[model samples]
Target: MQAIIFANRTGNELAPLEQYYCSALLPVGNKAVIEYTLEDIVTSGITKVKIIISSQAQEIEQLLGDGERWGLDIDYFLSKPEEKTAAVLDRLSLSMTDSIIIVRGDIFRSPCIANFIDFSKQFSNEFVQAKMANQNACMLLLPAALSYLDGIDWPLTHDYDSNSVVTLILHGRCHMIDSFQSYMNANLNLARNDIPSLTPMERSFTSANPEQDFYVGAKTHTGDLSLQNAWGIIGENCRIDPNVVMKNAIIIGNDTLIDKGSTLENCLILPHTYVGEGLEVNNSILCKKLLISLNTEGHIEIDDQALIGPSEHQASTSSTDRNLSTRFFILMLLIASLPFCPLLAFYALIRVMFFKLETKPLIQEMINDNLGRSLVTYSFNVPTRLLSLLPQLFLVVTGQLALFGAPAQIRYATGRNKQRLGVFGPVQLLLDEDAPEEERMLLMLEFDNTHTSTKYLSLLWRSLRIPRLLGAERKKQNMTH
Candidate 1:
């Protein structure tokens, strides 16, 4: 008989992290999250397995790929967010068999095969539905009276009280882990040290000697090391920088980096991070959007998803008010006094010797065109112009000024105010000039001070206090532009 493994993972509450790991890398002890469910399906001696994925589709693709790892001939089906339940099942039934085992990916399970086999065999009717005691544990038993479900509409009137026929509710077990905290607790109980010696679920696919393929996926670095589990899949796209040390950690997903001279122990590092050099990290799940530290002695929900920025500006910003305020004040002071610093003196000497600060010849020639017009030059010696840039350079180095932003132009006395001492140069200033007077002043100030750094910091701060500040402002700007 043929069996179809139906896996559905969709979570709205798990917004940021779910966008990456999804159902792919939930590790119980040394077992990958998807591995446990897949193992249950294939080991039940099912010939064909159909694994479906919702969000984190990329992660599902990377880890499972073509499903050659599962030993069974695996097929995949995708569903749109707007697609309804009936549509999902209809697509699956078109080319597949009637006997189907639907598994939820976000749910993890213990090493149990008998329970699932019983559900499939006894309930091998037109439809079978599985339920956990709650939603935090593996699926133990399901109602097998789905044959009667074929003719009935799944959506019924409010007055109809339908009772399920076969209900097996285990007293002590749950069906799913709804949050990251529960997931971490489940991992602590399931991972074992003897895993490398045992065959992993993926290895069950290889036709070669299974004993040779017994391997574990664990995080490794070239530096001094301390690892809890000596085996596990170090995702192919992960960057294990040199001089980094790791112990008892599993990494899932891609576009992640563990920077140099860092130590990680019993943690999950999700994708896209610098991991900051020379840090002591332990017992945490570093999702790009949130950091879940299972090592905490008490139950603390770190639901700060705002740490992960929306779109491409994730890395270049910080929202912590204390940090932002400190950086701004310190950078402002440093820049204001930087022109006279000793570093500028050394560079000024070089500039004078190399003639780099000499006014361009084109500017000298342009003086004729400005005969009647006011020609203003902040006349400074070659050495002085070189030194004049020191303040801005200091601001940039101090993390106040962005690498590239509109340079604050000196207000030229000419009626043509080409040079102004505001953050927004010509482009933004011109836009602001067209706005209503009161609104223009307010917006101009906002636009000027809203440097690349400020733009990111402001959005991050707003994302926490307000719902859609960054996305809304960005959309508005795009529309106007």
Candidate 2:
């Protein structure tokens, strides 16, 4: 039977991981993640497969070109995300009469296809899905013919029996790793499960030195080194350095070097990178272009494109504690004085009658509990008019304080030491591994705002809730992160 798999790689739902690696190239076992799923389909006697890809189609094409290796007739379809699923089925329906199976490329499944095929044979014009509930994987059959004009959403409440038609196979535990910690955790789990012990392509990619437990991709090279389960997918025409010790790792695409005495453990090194001598990378993922340290969660999504280019060429060399200098102190006095002109008259008029006014201290304790010190501190008996203005001036002068940052920090907040200056306001709370991306971007942008007036002004406008152009941009960035 022919299966038209709708393999769109644009998985925005997975977040930042989608920003870096495509689903097809995400390393799992001794091969890319999608390879395992494809093998299962081919083994189930589905000979003809059509793959749909958006960005990284070539990588899949290179691996499964003409599909002779797997004895399946394979073809590829490339299109924008919006034009993907429907477009492939529309083109396929014109020629093929056999049943089709549509599956997202990123999902990993096995030992469940036999049931799927049995279920699909029951319906002549139905869609079958490999559904997993808890540890049980079953095939769900649905009687829905191919109609590109109207997309159908399978009703969740539709009753089903062993013989009744059902819909897609949805896994109860299938999750896409979208962050650094999650990615790391997945690799760690796989490593703990002895994924590395699996043999590399026996006849295809192998090193001349024949060190044990080393993984090298097709037409790739690994120099003399004693390695164990070090996953390296060296593309065609790629070279490796000798004397490199890599363990529990993955390398993708092309052109990289592991300089002598470099040890990479439980990491992902992407293409076009050169690791210097005596480097130790553990539980990290490098895009050859960018380096990322994954947290305990096992997902790493480093913004590699931003790490490149002339605009942001340098790495984050500044210390985490580093922030805008005290040099911006001069701007403080000027800002604090601006609102004083009209405030003076208002204060005098109020002082004429109400003498019992016990003014509150303008300099409240900072979110971090740094006492007496503030971006700007005000004493008791400060004019009512000046009270409101002082806080705004304080935000402007400090340059570190944002007009609106995180929810205000509470007393004795732990991890406050990690706080950095932000464009809009100070993040009262400490950053955790699972901290949201908006918080990270805010901290990163703030730390980079070093005495640059242009950046400061831009941040100030962002804090002010500027209309249209800037506001829309802030919202978009917030939603994306």
Candidate 3:
């Protein structure tokens, strides 16, 4: 028997999800939507199949290459948006004796195809439609009836006429998910074991507690949370805080972090998402870029990444350690600052005498101490700005401030706006003080959250341009005043 899986559904209803992945690739549990259909076909003893895909075809092709993993010979065909479903099938050109099975990609079902085939052989119908609650489940087509569907429009509804249409009522699980609410419902049902198991990819990282209906993927860390009566599913490489309370939730996708003291109930937290601490997320889908509230049937795209941002892996301590590169860069700045250091010291001495210069605890030092205590501080003067920053080079050399890192913050800086101390930073060099406060804060948070070696080099280059930036800032300030 041959099979044709139509994965050509344009996931307009999926909205923000379609922006990232095709609906066929949407995670239903630990697996994609198409995986369940493939498993059904494989178990039915069909070894050859053709997948018709349109959006993100390359990604899907890469994901299920040749289908050897499932012991099946699979071929992929690209379908156009204008092409009818019947036209797509006509291109295959099956023989008159061939019995083919056609499965829709967007739906999730675990039907006994073998039994359907047996029924089809015994029955005299040319087209057999499987129905669940009076809705189309799937269809079986014989070769003799193939010519009648040539050039017909897609989405063969119940109104489609056939010489002999036999309806097979589905007794088991069948769910058609065309919207976000439907998708969420499907996942919740699956988590509650309302339907048959959707076979997950064979990976060593997956673990399932059948008793508690809890499924966890690999490389995931869960803190001390009670899972006695709750059904929870966590994806790979995720971090769950110890104070979290989760009940009947499906947290799929990788590298997600649930902050401390958060309560999640029947929520779908997408991959690469960061849930801030102490927020109650219930009946919602939290993608890295969007927050979908199932309760209100509405969604909002998240522009500020700090609130519900993308997942970021913490840099290893060794990578962020004061290495030779940092030391060399600090040394270069120190040498350059030598010419102005004595002058700045005299200026600072005079300012101290007049009570203009004051000692402030380094922000980095305060963060390290975690005591949240700091001393007095000298304000940056317009004419002596570069000279004043020159003193920080000594701190850079002493391994106190990184040459290129997050901007320095006061001891009272807390919440999302808190930043580490650096001698010079991307924000001070790139953003004018006149920039929107929210934009500046978000930018700094993003910089601190990202882990890249190139940022250090970029900061070094920006340091050279600092005098120009400072001059511009002063000019802007003077103009404003």
Top TM-score prediction, candidate number: 3
Using lDDT as the measure, the top candidate is 3
- Return the candidate ranking by TM-score, descending: 3, 2, 1
**TM-score of model 3 vs. true structure:** 0.61
**How far does residue 115 in candidate 3 sit from its true spot (Å)?**
2.3
Candidate 2 on 59-129: residue-level lDDT in tens?
56665667787888888877665353545556655444544555555544443454576766775565443
The TM-score values for the models, in the order shown, are: 0.43, 0.45, 0.61
Off by over 4 Å in 2: 11-20, 82-97, 122-129, 133-256, 296-481
lDDT by candidate, in order shown: 0.44, 0.48, 0.65
Prediction 1 global C-alpha lDDT: 0.44
Judging by lDDT, tell me the better candidate of 1 and 2.
2
